[model samples]
Target: MLQPLPQEQTIMAETDRISQLPADIVDNILGFLPIEDAAKTVVLSTNWGGIWPNLTQLCFAPHFFRRLKNRYSTKHAAFYVITKILLQHQGPTIRKFEVDYYDSKTETVKSRSYDIDQWLLLVTRKGVEEIKLHLGSQEYRLPDCVLSCRTLKSLDLDSLLVRPLRSTYMLPNVASLRFRSINLDFFSDLVLDVPSLENLSCEECYEMFHLHIIAKSICSLNIRYCSGRELDSFIPVNMDLRSIRTLHLDSHSLQNFVDDCSRTGLPLRSPALNVEDLNLSDFCFKEETQASPLIRLLHICPNLIKLHISLWCPVTWRCDSTYDDEKDIPSVAEVDRRLPELRSVAQRHKRLVTLKLILFKGFWCEMLFIKELLAALPSLQEVIIGHSNDMDSKRKCEVMERVLHFPRASTEANVTCI
Candidate 1:
């Protein structure tokens, strides 16, 4: 039926054949093997010789480093060789690249500085979409050309110092940033123009950071530091609050911010953070004060869906070992009346779904406060009550009952006793 295959078609099919296998069969068969081994398949015949370097997402982590370390006596020279190999490959672009840098025992910051800039520049020139730079003690500054990176999206700096710049350094498209230790005293401050930014985290930076929130698409934020609040400074109550869905605050810098907000009456600076998963820890109190200075924390985030509290008093608040049974125990109703405005405030926020109570040290006086709290959260679904096992069984059971019975609608909700 086919009158005989054309001569050009026959010649094309024969040349497409590699060794003895047909073109389709060899290509399909080669896809199953590792790239290195697949390249070795070329030795079986004269048809295939080079194929491994064209992969889109090139990986150079564990295996590459091991081979380099065994071949070369110096680790620095090994890093250079690896850097050259990655730079040589062309045509097929890298979509994502991850450099898991682990320095040897004797390596120091000065040893790795020069080549790091070269490697960063190479990846930048290749148009890397997402980059992760994780380093240990050998801390290095960011490269000069990082601002020019056009396609970079998310960046995470763990235990790295961002070199202070005189001019406003703009990461025009970076969406998410997470860092552990950074010196931000001379760093540039600008409107972070990431239109798609969703998450941001900074931990253990002591300097006061001044940043205007310009990202209209932000959703989650986590900041842990001890700056930005002076007794005289007016910090507003989340002025730009509509876009945020969650926030976690762990700043021990101030004794009490909401009370400070109340005393100053600063709308621009209110301690109230509107979030779906709000967590606050007040670890800035001295145990020896005569009066209760930490009581006002209950009203801080009135609408938080989840709350975790841990309070510690200095040695002065610690009671003597001797018994004082004659002293009266405070009534739950009396403590409840002090928080009249807080419960009403919580009722307005629709996101309070869960509550967690973390009490570092507590005794008789604070228990009544805890019982009243169980009765306060109207829509609470579950509760986690944690206390050091400083008490015996009888007191623990009584404490457990207060938390378990309060959530009216949660018939099957869990109450963890820790």
Candidate 2:
């Protein structure tokens, strides 16, 4: 067998040397560079170019490096340059397209171009995988073809808003989805079945953030600032997400959560999946009592270990002429549901280890929130309280003493307060 000649060896070294790097090692290094920079390697030689097309993961975002270059140079062609690279890439192995378009410019005027649609079509047709689209603009939906694509894995639509968009598309394969500042008012008949999904996020849901999840594989999620008085339209009981792990919930009204709770198979009762972390925010300004969903989380997330909660222990009361038989003094719900819940893993229950309570106004007192939590979570190693506010000198000592002392309520258990 004759070995390759000198010229052949030299040419092969330039083009095929990259193949020598372990596959995972190559991906790790390429992962750090923007997709365009990663693609630029191809120009180095055929070997490096081939590495990009075979990349199982891709991230294309503007690194803030230019921000460090000069104090004033950053406010220029950064976004347009990102768009340019996305359109130029013609690879099929892309698993993630993270387009973080935050305006670094003070007064940058950008004109709309149809190039976004063209590039989107190219990726979809070639079986590009995950897409994380984050824009700082009020543009709500991407082109129909991009959203309607069938091969997406995870999508994060952040800082999105209402714009000129029409009714179209059904996502069949996208799991792990997110929508931020989105107006889905035009989405009347949207349906989805993303069984492979692991997370779903929605923010600023003033208008209906309409969509459905047929997947039970979700692990981390966030639904915040959703003023949709009725959540049945956004998330029905039929959307059984039993696999949730990390969850952040903020709804417009109590009705939103209750409407969901009333749904058949929608009591947050999913198959035995470990839901470990939960953050409940976006409290309703007016509520008769704590919503049912929160009460249900204690019962549902049997494996929850970390918790972050923000609630409105209303400083004011409603003058419902009929219900106000008693003089209206400030009132918060005496909800028993949370008292036991804070105890579920010791309220932190199920090996609950960390707790962060922010804006812990009335709800904690309603359920003896702090007392029950200190009682239930014996496994707690760290606790952050009054996080939203800093403790003054006197208050700091008082707060620390209470926290450290509570763990010893039974027989002087050991708990360090820092």
Candidate 3:
């Protein structure tokens, strides 16, 4: 029984409704948007400037800034605006801070290291929970303030120097860590004192004399080789995990670890045996390739429920002096013809349910291996075959049809080709 308000007054009321949203709610809404877009909300109303500062997540990736007409000028402008935002931000609590500052050839990393350190220092003071820092070059090292940040719960470092400052440096609360393209040759023991850490991923790291992953709560691990030739000189890496659920090991890394343990007379058993999901990638096979290393690894992982394998086939060119022609090169087939023998290796796994075959190159040897696997595993529930996108559809269909006809021990087993 109230009279309708005037049109302008109704509009004003609607606008006020949005402006009156709780500060935390407004901050959360802004947190989902890129910092640049969040800052643009300042133009919506006078109150938005204060609301933008309350945002808890700050991400400064390449697309967070406006694209300038001159591509070369964007880096400098981005750096300037980023510095200004850090200086102006008054947020007392930050949950996440991610910075992926990739610059073109014109701007050198040496010039931006100080600004990056300053920005990191500002975020560290705000009690940042998760931090991901990816720089353009290896020369830029992360500031000590970041490494020593006790409040951090997650960290992903790429292309940075991560040498420890002292004997007992600690990340008390960190639960997840990832290192990509990092140099760890200087540290004798890369001790992970984070008892809360559950996930660890290390890839493309410099050859370390010793890597001591001492996280007691770790449940998932992934390690891939950076360089294949350096495996011979690698030190025996030790892991003290409680009960890992998932483990992924590339061909070179698995081979190196196994060889190191064999040479040092150290027990090859660990928490990795409890792994239920296993992924093996970058695995190459030749006539001379030894299958004992991979077979032994599978033997230890008796509880594996899922298995993934990606085969690597290398191209070898043999020049003939008699032909005197560079174009007349013979094609080399690398997938081992004896790969069918792997069925014996996998027969012990009575619990295996899912098998994923990735990057299959339509080789007859590979098809034989698949046939053997289908016939050997009685409990197999499903088989996923992943192939290259560029493969001919007709050829792929033919391959799938052939695999569908393979003798399966389980009648309920289904084959999926992707």
| lDDT string, candidate 1, 323-399, tens digits | 13314434323433444544444444344567676763444334434444455556666667786555566666665
Q: Which of candidates 1 and 3 is the stronger one according to TM-score?
A: 3
lDDT (10s digit) by residue, model 3, range 1-418 = 9766799788888878877777788877877777777778756876666766667888876565436315556456667777887787777888888877665452455677788889889888999999988775777877789878999999999887766766555888988988888776655654657778888888887764345555766788887865432554453244543267787878877776557655656455432357788888866443233345676676567788898888655433121111123224331233333444466657767788999988865555456567777887778998999975544787777777877898987776789988
How well does each candidate superpose onto the true structure, as a TM-score? 0.63, 0.68, 0.82
Give stretches of model 3 more than 4 Å off: 1-22, 41-49, 65-74, 104-107, 228-238, 260-272, 285-290, 315-341
Q: Candidate 2, residues 1-418: lDDT per residue as tens digits?
A: 9999999999988887666777567766877787667766646654455565566555656464354224556444554554565555555556656666566442332333344455566667767677666666654337666666788766777665433243434466766677776766645455456666677776775556355446666777676666554555555323545667787776443345445554544556432446688777644322434444455556556687787766454445321121123334243333344345435535335466777766533222422456566676656666666522433456556554555555422332344433
TM-score for candidate 1:
0.63
| Sort order, lDDT high to low | 3, 2, 1
